[model samples]
Target: MEILIPLTASLVLLLIGYFIGTILEKKHYQSINDREEKFINLPSVTMTYRAASKETDMSKYSKTQLVSGGVVVSIDYFKRFLALLRNFFGGRVSSYETLVDRARREAILRMKEQSSGADMIINVRLETSTISSSAGDSETVDSIEAFAYGTALYK
Candidate 1:
């Protein structure tokens, strides 16, 4: 009888813990989604303008070029950070999904901004780099760069 009582109590506590954990996880996901959506909505610029030349004029098409620029406004290392923390806690990395999603969104935004004004941006190349980072045992940084290029057209 004594053992049964203790086991029942333990089970109840475990259930409570599970419920709380789930609630917290849901909240976290919601917050992340909101934040990511906001960032995605930030005003962005589109650069470069290009147009294809006549098929007969290979030289013009070959010489056609447009310059597009995009700034790496944000570099979030927190995603990797959360993953590391989860590893330390011996838990699956459910928390890093947000980070991954954010990175992809940011990349697309940067590239889109760079190619925004181009008549038809083609042969786009995206480059990601870490421009600078604070030196510290506990400091980490992640950055992304995007480059878009296309032929310019003017009537």
Candidate 2:
């Protein structure tokens, strides 16, 4: 039947997309982990506005600067399909969770990389936004941007 051919083709395309997406996701995660490890000893990063009294004497540092990092990540077709289904059912869209998480982590890692010589990073902040792309006649959320920023102190 005509329907059978189109249906089969759609399913095959979906399967291919899913497999390729999964592989790319795994590779990205691995890269993130490796970068994180490389920066593990660079500096202490924190979200608190002020350093603890006992930690250090701020007057000694003599310099402070702002540092930031940002990353944009796109959602794969498979994840978009799952998210659409979840929207109709009114449940948690777990499929997008990893995408957001990865973006956040990557942004922070990049920030750390930028301030490799700093003694510490304080008042860390993160921001996220969705990017839309036009497909055919409609616009859809195609990617997310995560930004991380903080103050870096130097001796």
Per-candidate clashes come to 4, 0
Worst 10 residues of 2 by lDDT: 44-53
**Which residue pairs collide, candidate 2?**
none
Model 2 spans > 4 angstroms off: 47-49, 52-54, 134-139
* Candidate 1: residue 23 lDDT (0-100): 66
- Best by the TM-score measure: 2
Per-residue CA lDDT of model 2 for 1-155, tens digit only, reads: 88799888868877887899899999999999999898887664565645543576778787888999999999788788889889899878998999999999999999998887898888788999988866654637679999999998888
- CA lDDT, every prediction? 0.46, 0.85
lDDT of 2 at 72: 98
Model 1: weakest 10-residue lDDT segment is 47-56
lDDT of 2 at 17: 70
RMSD of 1: 10.8
As a TM-score, model 2 comes out at 0.88
- TM per candidate comes to 0.38, 0.88
Clashing pairs in 1: 49-118, 50-151, 50-152, 51-151
